[model samples]
Target: MSALRVALADDQALVRAGLRALLERLGIEIALEADDGAALLAQLADTPVDVVLSDIRMPGVDGIHALQALRARGDATPVLLLTTFDDSELLLRAAEAGAQGFLLKDAAPEDLFDAVTRVAAGETLLQPVSTDPVRARFHFRDDRAPVDSFNPREVAILRLLAGGYSNREIARSLFLAEGTVKNYVSVILDKLGTRDRTRAVLKAITLRVI
Candidate 1:
């Protein structure tokens, strides 16, 4: 496979340089580097980058704004958000903005690389409970209908799956073992009559079940 072509967007010069060095050492291509969102946006007009790695709190045009702009223009370049904030609301906003993943800035170097790879591969960043539980909690407010095939626990698990949470995170969020969550995910997929989480979410959205 081609080395992942990446862009580094951050206001701090040193941080950008350090990230570039690390990614380069990993053999990933540094397609572009920018100090802020506006610069990143400018680079995109001429440079075809695969993954955009951005600081969430840059000056002028922030990461969130950049994400919105990218999505608005139908640019599907996967974005990995780097931030110090563990705020759930911010995470929710990032998810809604179509950010592919979230990474704590202080994370170890390998963690950063892993996040980039996972996001580029179309997996969500490490959301502990996925976004499904939150979405289900907020969107699935009414109990007008029930699934005849699934029990309440199954439905609860399925809701998390639909929201896009990973199995490991779902396990921790629900206080279940990792293996249990994996089983739950498999069972949820079978019960929902869908192939995967994204499709399951789409199905729920289509049926108004989530």
Candidate 2:
């Protein structure tokens, strides 16, 4: 495989320098570095970067806004948020803005490397704290909820999951087998355009699906 070229965006020059060294040791190339979102976007347009590692908070622009800008410009290069906090609201916003993954600022060197690799390969990787509760909140709703994409069965299943019901509880409530509930949950994940249960719900919520 070709070496993954990455752009790192953060206001901290020391952090960028350290990250550059770490990634270089693993044979990754630093295509560019930026102090804020706007510079990051300019670099992305000017350079060839397979992945973007961005800080959630910066001086001129923020990570979520940068993510939105990339998507609006139709760039599908994977974007990962590097953050120090794990707020659910921020998680929801990141997912909605099209971030492929989120890594804690204090993550181990190996963890950062793995996140970069996975997201560049079109995978979503999130820290456990930011990934788990998403399962309890994503769903089908609004005008689109009644469509075939959701339907009554899928809606029922989502409501149960969002309310903290287990598969068995959902099955009992819906008069379906436990396996059937599991299957519906799988379908929910696929139709919602997300990487996992949390992301799925966040997508559903963003789309007003649930």
Candidate 3:
């Protein structure tokens, strides 16, 4: 198969350089690089790439804005957001804007490469471990719909999932059938308005569900 071409956008030169080196070492082609979101969009208009790796924060036209612009223009390119920390609110916004995945900037090279490949291949990702910090910071609010909306069982399952528990493990811990855990997970995702577990976990943190 031909090497996958990727576009990168980050205000930090060094971050972009580091990502470029890592991607190249993995035999991925760097189709375009931009210092900010608008430039990234402009480059996308002129070049075709398999995936876009963008930093969530930027000086002008951040990753969220860029993603909205792309979606507004009917562009279907997959996007993987990078960040220095697991910002629950920011990542939740990215998901609403159609981001395919979120990864910490300091993530291992293998993690980065795998994320790029998976997103390029049209799969969504949100690491259980990566979302742990936000999960840990979850402060339940009575007024939040998420906190008030999810049942006790859903809440328990979410906590376990954040701890990197598999469905089987969560089932075992909660003393429920695996099928029951799966149903609860699906309900949690629906309530959080996310399609995948990663986004659901991030949204839950943003909504203070845990």
The most accurate candidate by lDDT is: 3
- Ranking, lDDT, top scorer first: 3, 2, 1
Backbone clash total for model 3 is 0
Question: Candidate 3 lDDT, tens digit per residue, 91-145?
Answer: 7667667888788887898988888887887766655234455555544443366
lDDT by candidate, in order shown: 0.75, 0.76, 0.81
Deviating ranges (above 4 Å) for candidate 1? 128-139, 143-210
User: 5-60, model 1: which lDDT tens digit per residue?
Assistant: 99899999999998999999987899999999999998987898879999888889
Which of the two candidates, 1 or 2, achieves a greater TM-score against the reference? 1
* Runs off by more than 4 Å, candidate 3: 128-210
Clashes of 1: 2
Worst 10 residues of 2 by lDDT: 126-135
**Number of backbone-clashing residue pairs for each candidate, in the order shown:** 2, 5, 0
lDDT (10s digit) by residue, model 2, range 47-161: 9789999988887788889889999999988898887665666766787677787788888888788878877876665443343445444544453643457887887776555
Best by TM-score: 1
